[model samples]
Target: MTNSTLAQLLDPAITPRLVVKVGSALLVGKDGEPRREWLTALVAELAAARARGQDVIVVSSGAIALGARRLGLAKGGRGSLADAQAAAAVGQIALAGLWAELLAGHGLTAAQVLLTLDDLEERRRWLNVTATLGTLLARGAVPVINENDTVATEEIRFGDNDRLAARVGQAAGASAVLLLSDIDGLYDRDPRLPGATRIPVVRRVTPEIRAMATGGSSSGLGSGGMTSKLQAAEIAGLAGMALAIIDGQPVAPVGEALASGRGTLFMARPRKGARKAWLGGKLRVRGSVHVDEGAAAALARGSSLLAAGVTRVEGSFVRGDAVSVVGPGGDVLGRGLCEYDAGECARLIGRHSREHEEILGYAPRSALVHRDQLVLI
Candidate 1:
């Protein structure tokens, strides 16, 4: 967490695109039901980002807090899992309504998008989520996203929205992810303990740095603590998105951190524009495409996923994204972005790339997917 040399200067006031994650602890006041007026200030800051021609997506947590407070459920962390689930169901409605109202005040509409691990774990669904968010950002709409707690099983949880925000930023190709927490930022040690120091920046997450991390919040507002923040940083870094941990309690700390690098900043991955990085660092893979040895060789030799070498297309996938290429015997040989839909891929089985125009009546380009978009697995 404390590699100051690796830290780069940032100004949220000028950063063009960012994913802002507000933890449940930060949004829930003592009275619960979502600290209404506090959200207004956050919205104002977001509006400022929008005015700067930046795309901002918010991954927020507060449903459980609202639900627990509204239904008079216990907040002592002694509640059963069922009780927490019920609280999330009640809190979701309140959280969505509050976000809609607050975002509306700035004349910007807010759209609610809820997902679980499946949304990121399934390749087809993952790309679908990606394209949808990209289109939303293009239209200048702010997306208020959260986990589908009512339906998400415990096994598939991301632990917290910190990681979710990091994934969203990567999927949307966001420039940065701002993790808002109670702490000002990562420190050399747990600041609550004596002799601990506030660490303003981090270049990389060395093991020694991780050793200094603390878990969750003693104040009951935080669950993932600094540990979760580190996890989120790892996710964002893999996607080549800048990561920042900053104070969420302040009115505009997110903006301040973005604009001035006032918090701990994690560098993005080493290489940019390298699709292989994305493929190797993938969160999950749903299905695969089977190719013959010749096709595999062609891919390794910098050729595309031509129809001829494709022995069989496994699993269902939409066009314009990445997929795994298996050998004739089911060995995954490579992964590449596809040009044609799975249905069409099935139709073109074993045909020549030139046959595309003859069969489909219109060619959508030569290879089913280009080599440039493919990565050898």
Candidate 2:
């Protein structure tokens, strides 16, 4: 793999859609309040990036830490889920207020977006999120996103903002993702060790690279460790977005990281279209639709999967859930977001588009899977 620098990635010629992840360690002070001066500097950097025609989205983590301090909860311990949820409910207001005030100073409006795991997991929900964020960006508003801790259960929680930031970058089709943390970059071993060395760039996240993560958090206020950051990098790579992990303790950390090229940069692959990216990476297929050779050939020729082409439907899946499209001999052709649920699809198989309304009593869509939603293997 070739080594790369942040300076090369942040070229002025390339105006990027940037997703910035700020951890609680850099956002909250010892007194449980926002670190106003540091945040102000960061806002200045963001404003400069905007001036250069870059669109910025921030994924911030500080609500739970600030709330814990407000509620007199002891530090460095995973408290009860109820208490954590309660703290998030209170702390979110403070977090939003601080961000709004900071961005407003530069004449930029900040919009709060609280999301749960389901928001990214469900196809319909994911589309809604992408549209909302797109509209906000077009209107020159900065979207401050965070997990909805208030309603999120352990089963649905993202656990850390690093992975959430990666998902946000993927969903938003961002060109780059910046992870600001206490440590500057990834190291071959813990930096405290005598012979440890920093890895400047990563082209691919192999098993050896994952093994380098020691899962150590630098601050008590943040939940993510190096392991989580590596996981985030892998996600970003798959989404075709470059990711950088840099030290956030300094004033104008984003600017400094770009200027000095002192961060671990994970190179992204060639980007896929939005539908293809989501279909290939983020989805969990709930069912399979097997089609005959004619249907498979049509799909290969970039045609939509029609009800007339489907031979059988397997497993239970709801409308808009991702489902596998398989060939007659069980070879997986691709995946797509289905227009009809399993029951509807089963009844419509081998029927013509003109017969859909008569067979199902209502024809919401003619194709079982549209070409726009299909991603070939």
Candidate 3:
């Protein structure tokens, strides 16, 4: 699509947030050196977007590549997981510094954020991640995110930055994710073969589309290929966030390819409040909070669940666990992220908000469940 089409799809007045993913090949060379000029151009695009009153989050991969080189480990990160982690430890500093330096040039502050699979999967940590990212954006800072490779176990690793970027986009409630890749866009067939043609836009990912995506990066620097990009598109689409793949190999300014209609845009599903959809779809209720009739009525009116409204707390769940709110007649009013642990809820049940400090020995946030975190059944 052309820049006008792209702008209409991601109008700042509507879809104000965008997530950009930079692959290892785009940010780091095979010689293990940072591609300063390329990244400098990319950051300029990000700054321009921010100037247009849009939020930009970057999911970047290159630490492991740079770190592997610094540790003199095998090429292509062909080493033990421990060796890879060590390399990540060394390279993450430089990677973070590069982004900070470049963004600083545009008078934009860069916040380094490292995440793992569990951080996004677990409800509490997910809230923290969302809150942090939201705060950074509100304060006009760009978040440069990467996987926590240094400490993330193999079992918890995202495997590629593409999926990581999608998850970040979902968590941040971004309008779209831009995957900067070596290829211009998804092709009907392998581009190396004759008669291959680029697919300009994808409204959905079908089995036929899956057949076209190939795996394994030729550059050997990236863990993700077209297959992973397709996977990312599905993930982002489900979360109501569009995904675009554009070639970042060009020396021209970043976003030039997309502006010139040289990329694939995978459209998102109609958004129904991204966070609430996630909370409603994925959260497993760990406990129950039985509330009085008044509380249930208040919840129906879209007010937060206050301490006085809670009749009893059931199940052994800590603060931040998803809990079903039950009415006096055993009807489930809704479910939400519990603000207090089961033990704390038990102590505060039927008490006034003013008495919470005396009862709990410390002041805690009011409301057993905040309205923003609650979703009606």
Span of ten consecutive residues with least summed lDDT in model 3: 1-10
Q: What is the lDDT of residue 220 in candidate 1?
A: 84
TM-score leader: 2
Best by lDDT: 2
The Cα local distance difference test for each model comes to 0.75, 0.85, 0.84
The better-scoring model by TM-score among 1 and 2 is 2
User: Against the true structure, candidate 3 has what lDDT?
Assistant: 0.84
The reply for model 2, stretches above 4 Å from the true place, is: 1-3, 283-377
Least well predicted 10-residue stretch by lDDT in candidate 2: 1-10
**lDDT for each residue of candidate 1 in 1-377, tens digit (9 for 90 to 100):** 12342122134343567888988877888777577667888889888778767788999998888888888888622276777778889888999889888888889888889988878765677788889998898887899999887777677777678878887877787878888888778888878789878776666666667887888665585467788788778667666677887777777665655555557777776544534545544544545778888887787788888888877777778886557788876656656678888888888989987677888888557688787777654
Residue 47 in candidate 1 has what lDDT? 87
Task: Tell how far residue 153 is off in model 3, in angstroms.
Answer: 1.8
Tens-digit per-residue lDDT, 1-377, candidate 2: 12366864454355378898999989998778889899999999888877778899999999887787777876522478888887888888999999999999999999999999889887789899999999999999999999999999987878899989989988887888899999999999888899989899889777788888878786878889999898788768767888899999999998887777788999886677876777755535799999999999999999999989999999999898889999998877888899999999999999999998988897559589999988765
Per-model TM values vs. the true structure: 0.70, 0.76, 0.72
lDDT of 2: 0.85
Task: RMSD for all candidates, in order, please.
Answer: 8.4, 6.1, 9.3
